[model samples]
Target: MKTLWVLVIAWASVAPAASMPVCSGGHRVNCVVDGDTFWWRGKKYRIADIDAPETDASCEAERRLAAEATSKLKDLLANDFAVEPTGRFDRYGRRLVIVKIDNKSVGETLIAAGLARRWQGRKEHWCPAP
Candidate 1:
């Protein structure tokens, strides 16, 4: 009985850490890595619910938009912004978060500007095939 109780306690402790970080409040961003990623207090975070063009894109159009997205994210994070975790993490270990600037989500802003798209469980092409 005692062994079973110990195992249950151990599982409870490990479960939350294995899931994802939950942001009850917010944290100051240290730097913006891209339109969908940033650094806060030395930890890397990925914006939740949205995906942006990759910085190392091959297609010309994708590359161009990726640069624009990165620049826009940099500008947003340069001010007094905060990141709210989405209680999830990507496979790459980036914390899924929502960046808020003036109470507006940066991801939503990027999507509105056509620089990003809402993440739908898979990556979508940023440019058409040649």
Candidate 2:
């Protein structure tokens, strides 16, 4: 009984992040370039804030999981909305954009959904007038 109870508590603690639904980031785009890259309007974009798992891994499970996450993000954004650059250029040279679906900022939406992290470290001015 004691061992079973401990196992249950451990599973409960890790479940939320694992079960978290894959949702769209507020900056909607066309597709993923890699685990960390994406495309929007003939331009390439890297996620401005979060460092997701790298595609390279010794374990196949780790690699597949990262690929799946990127695929899920792209799948959710397909044909769903229009987006504009946020006026910020990330270190990778992709223009940051405020994605809009039905006139909603995709960035805000993604953050709210816990799909993407708020990039408070990035300066707002980096997003150019668009």
Candidate 3:
């Protein structure tokens, strides 16, 4: 019985937990990774419906937008949200998912807020060509 209790406690420690707005790196289990990705219970997930600006983008505009988008995503995930898998994974092997809160798509929310754009099956660079 003691051994069983210890096992249960160990499992509980590694279980998926409440979302927290943390993106500063280093093995986060349940925290936002960026504008379009996050970690939940040691699993990485990519938002499947929209593409937010990338933090590594060369353009300053993109970098700023990425920060805002990331912040917005963090805010949304801070509450009770659902991670519905699309049964797919991106080229990078991140599980594709659509996050929702109260049946409203989180991607749509980011789009409405101008922090992200609909995923059109192609990469649309957020920086304008000089």
lDDT over C-alpha atoms for residue 31 of model 2: 48
RMSD of each: 10.4, 17.4, 6.9
Q: Would you estimate the TM-scores of all the predictions? A: 0.74, 0.48, 0.83
Give the per-residue lDDT of model 2 (tens digit) for 63-126: 6656665665555455355544456787768865554456565455555544445566742221
Per-residue lDDT of candidate 1, residues 1-130 (tens digit): 9999986554321111111222224563355666788666658889897999987777889989988888887766666665666678999999888777776887899999999999999988887877
Model 1 stretches with alpha carbons more than 4 Å out: 1-29
| TM-score-based ranking | 3, 1, 2
Ranking by lDDT: 3, 1, 2
Which has the greatest TM-score? 3
lDDT against true structure, model 3: 0.83
Q: Give the per-residue lDDT digits (tens) of candidate 3, residues 34-128.
A: 78898887798899999999999999999999999988888888777777777799999999988888768989999999999999998899999
Better of 1 and 3 by lDDT: 3
Question: By summed lDDT, which 10 consecutive residues of candidate 3 come out lowest?
Answer: 9-18
For model 2, give the 10-residue run with minimal summed lDDT: 12-21
Tell me which residue pairs clash in candidate 3: none
